[model samples]
Structures are given as structure tokens and as C-alpha cells.
Target: MKNASRLFLALIGLSLVVPVFADKDPNINAIKARQGEMQIRAHNLGPLIAMAKGKMPYEPKLAGQLAGNLKLLLDLDTSRDWPPGSDNKSYPHKTRALPNIWTSYPEIGKYGKDYATSVNELNAVAGDGLEALQSKIGAVGNTCKGCHDEYQEEHQH
Candidate 1:
């Protein structure tokens, strides 16, 4: 009975140590941070897209605010959130970023510049009128789609 009690105590001690010694993913936090940023982008862009589509009534004040939010997001320095080896291939289903995002280097920079251009244009005209918003919003959406098509895996429904 003493031996059985000692064995149980030993097993409990091992369980406590095992987790501390476990190989935890180092890139998980970076992946989550980047994902959160994208979610915020989508949250800000969604209303503007809806208004542009005429599905939602275009309120100039709201249009300007949402576009401003997207433009503000562009100013965030997110390089750390996109560290190498944090892609979906490395982290699997935890992320949708493809390995080519890192492998392709500055090739992706053009897409970013394009996105910025689109967002800036949208921001300038979003408060002007619904017609103005419609004209520039497509360009912004296209820039987003361009990057996602190249770097992000298709999100499964």
C-alpha cells in the first residue's frame, strides 16, 4: 500500500513537470496578433463596403469614419506580427498566411503600396458623397483581394 501511494505521488509530480517542459509554439502569439489586425480591418471595412453596394444606406459621417479607421490601420507597424515561419504552412490551420509571404520578400510590397493608395483615395472621398465612395471603394476591395489571393489560403466555410 505504501508503494502504491508513492507511485501515485510520483505520477502526480511528473504530470506537473510535463507541461512546463512541453514544446510550446513560439509563433502562436504572432499569428494571433496578425489575425486580430485583419479582423479589425474587416470590421472597419465591412460597413463601407455595404454602403458602397447600396445594401446599407450611405451616411456620409459613417462612411468617413469607417474609411478613416482603415486609413489609421495602415499606420500601424505590424512587422513583428508577420515574423518569418509564422505562416499557415508552419502553423497549419492556426493561420491562413502562406509561406510565400515570407519567401517572396519585396514582391509583396507592391500589393501593400497598392492597398495604401486605394485606402488613401477612399479616405479622401468617403465623406464627399455616395457616388464618391462607390468610385473608390472598389479599388480598395480589389487591393485586399489581390493580397489575399496571393498570400492567404481560402477560408473554409
Candidate 2:
């Protein structure tokens, strides 16, 4: 009985120490670089999305190129590749990312899905030709607004 009690106590003590001694990721630098790339690509995405929406004067060829770019960006595997904090950290980058993104991760993911859907819709319009592109531009813009409303900072345009 005494041995059992002592063993239990030892196990408890080890559990307490294990977390404190656990290693932190040493790959922060690599993570930051990947995050930076994500930000650059993400920033460019807005304009492409906008172009596809025909917010600017429409050229079918330009719209097609923008659609391709948007698809490329959407396809990037962020699971292991995207860095942390390079885009969202408060001081260094003036990112519009809302604090709620990390807090409400599920909702943020939903916004990502919505963004992809909007991009796909825009692509379809582009493929259909500029005549069908006008209203869909607003539809894509709404996705941007939805994401920004929840996940980004307000900007005065």
C-alpha cells in the first residue's frame, strides 16, 4: 500500500514537470517566412478579385488572367507552408486582420470557404465573358466585406 501511494505521488510530480520542460517550436523563423509569402499573395488577391468583379474597366483577357491568379493563390497548401504572425502580428504589419480570427477560428475558416466560393463564381463569370460579369462582381465584393467585417480592420476607402 505504501509503495502504491509513493508511486502515485511520483507520477503526479512527473506530470507537473513535463509541461514546463516541453519544447517550443524552433522553426519560428521558417514559419515567419512562409507567413510573409502568404500575406503577399493574399494582398494581391483582393485586387484580382476586384478585377474579376469588374470594379475596374473590364478586359476579358485580363479577367481571365486574374482568375487564374486567384485560383493559384487559393490552392496554396497553408497547412504546413504558411508562416505564423508575419501577416497578423499587431505592430510590424498593418494587417487588417481582426483579432477575432484566432479567437473564432471556425468562423475564420468559414470565411475562407466563402472567399473561395466567391472566387469560383468570379471565375465562372470571367469564362462566360464580360457581359455576364457585372452583378457577380458585387457578389464577390460581398464576400470580401463579410470576411473583413469579421476578420479584418476597417479602412476608409
Candidate 3:
């Protein structure tokens, strides 16, 4: 019985140590952070997209609030989230970021700047009226697509 208890305790200690080692991996943390940021952006944008598409009732105040939240998220400096070895090619199946992002840094930086501009536009007029929001949604989406097209790997069905 004492041996069994010691074995169980040893296994529990190993489990705790394993996660500590995993957390020390910068590549894993970078991928996780970027994925989390994308998830947050999606959460903030979902309702705005639905309203813009006429799938949801337009609420001007809510739209403004969501857009503001999205703008704040976009304004964050996420350079650390794309560190070396975090690309899809290096960490296959863990990230969708293409290696091209590092190679074509200037182009990707432009895309990021454009995305920030789109978010600013959305924040400016999201509360003005549905028409205004609808007008800018396409620009915001296009900015997203511009980066995704070149920097992200295509998803398989």
C-alpha cells in the first residue's frame, strides 16, 4: 500500500512538471497567444458581421461597443505573437501563419497597418447608423482577407 501511494504521488508530480516544461516552449506559447487573439477578434466581430449581413437586428449602441472592443484588440502590439519558429511550416498543425510572413515582412507589415486602419474606420462609424456600418464592413473584411490570403495556410475541408 505504501509503494502504491508513492507511485501515485510520483505520477502526480511528473504531471505537474510536464506542463511547466511545455510552458517554457516559446513557440508553443506564441502559437497559443496568436490563436487566442484570433478567437477574441472573431468573438467581437461575429455580431457586427451578422448585423451587417441583415442576419441580425441592428443595434447601434451594441455595434459601437463591439467595434470599440475590436479596435482595442487590434491596437495591441502583437509582434511577439509571430516570433521565429512559430510559423505553420515549423510547427505544422499548430499554427496557420505562413513562413512567408517572415520573408515578406514589409508586405505583411503593410497588411497589418491596413487592418488597423480598417478597424479605426469601423470604430468611427459603427455607431453612426446601420448604413455606415454596412459600408465599412466590407473594407474590414477585405483587410482581413488580404493578410489571410498571403500569410495563412488554407484550411482543408
Candidate 4:
């Protein structure tokens, strides 16, 4: 009887743990998708930022290509990557998206639209000249900062 009771308790414990582990994969995948998209945006924007800062020589053709790539990335519908379970409250350290994102849905959409507009403007003048690119770069950066400030949680490390 003692052995049976121990086995029953162990089975109950295992059952409780199993659902938690099962639910994690979808949340993990969503977080990864969000992170991956951000990484791609950074990759597309890195060269333009370097050129704008004079760290790299401004190549009009390359700048144009990068800007176009950025526009394409911005064009993606990213809402799907931000399901409720993917928020920091659900996944903790694995995701930086704050719970406020779900609550502030309208603001989030506005920010996304504003970012798309800024990127569109950048795409238009990317190959014009260094001066043109420099003028627009700050706006693009500001849009990113605005969204990040409101929607993303600060990283402690």
C-alpha cells in the first residue's frame, strides 16, 4: 500500500509538469520568431547606420538595396509573432515584449504604421546622396526608439 501511494504521488507530479513543458514550445517559438524578425531588421539597417555615422563610406547603390530590404522587412505583418502567450509576463526572460502591448493594441499598430512610413521615406531617398540618407536616418531611429520605449521591457543584462 505504501509503494502504491508513492507511485500515485509521483505520477500526479509528473502529470502536472508535463502540461507546463508542453505549453512552452509554442511560446518559445513565438518568442524566437519575434527575435528573429528584429535581428533581420537590424541586419538590414546596420550598414545604413554605419554609413550615416561615417563609419562606412556611403555607397548609393548599397544604401538603396539595404533600404529596400528594410522596407520589405517592415512590410511583413508582425502581429502574428506577438500572440498573448509570447509576452514577457508569460515567458519572462525569454521575451522582451511587455504585457502592455496587448493592452495598448491601437498604439502598437500606430507605431508600426509610423515605422513603415519612415522606412518608406528612407527607401525613396537612399540612393540620392549621403546628405539625404543622413537627414532621414534619425527619423527611422526615432520610430524604433519610440516603439521600443513603450512596448519592450528593459534588459537587466
TM-score to native of every candidate shown = 0.83, 0.57, 0.86, 0.82
Clashes of each: 0, 4, 0, 0
Candidate 3 segments exceeding 4 Å error: 1-22
Error of 2 at 78 (Å): 2.8
- Distance from true location, Cα of 49 in model 2, Å: 7.6
Locate the minimum summed-lDDT window of 10 residues in model 1. Answer: 18-27
In candidate 3, what are the lDDT values of residues 1-157, reduced to their tens digit? 9999999999999999988667877889888988999999889899999999999999999999999998999768888888976888888888898998888777788988899999999999999999999998888889889989989999978
Task: Report the lDDT tens digits of candidate 2 across residue range 1-157.
Answer: 9999999999999999876555254234444545586566566556655655556666677766666666677787765532344345542343545556666556678877987887788677664665666546666668767877876666657
Sorting all predicted structures by lDDT, with the top scorer first, yields 1, 3, 4, 2
Residue 10 miss distance in model 4 (angstroms): 33
lDDT-better candidate, 1 vs 3: 1
Question: Which 10-residue window in model 4 sums to the lowest lDDT?
Answer: 20-29
lDDT per residue as tens, model 1, 31-81: 877899999989999999999999999999999999999999999998888
Ranked by lDDT, the better of candidates 2 and 4 is 4
Q: What is the model-wide C-alpha lDDT for candidate 3?
A: 0.90
Q: What is the model-wide C-alpha lDDT for candidate 4? A: 0.88
Model 4's TM-score against the true structure:
0.82
- List model 4 lDDT by residue over 47-141, tens digit each: 99999999999999999999999888976787667887678888787888998998877778888888989999999999999999999988898
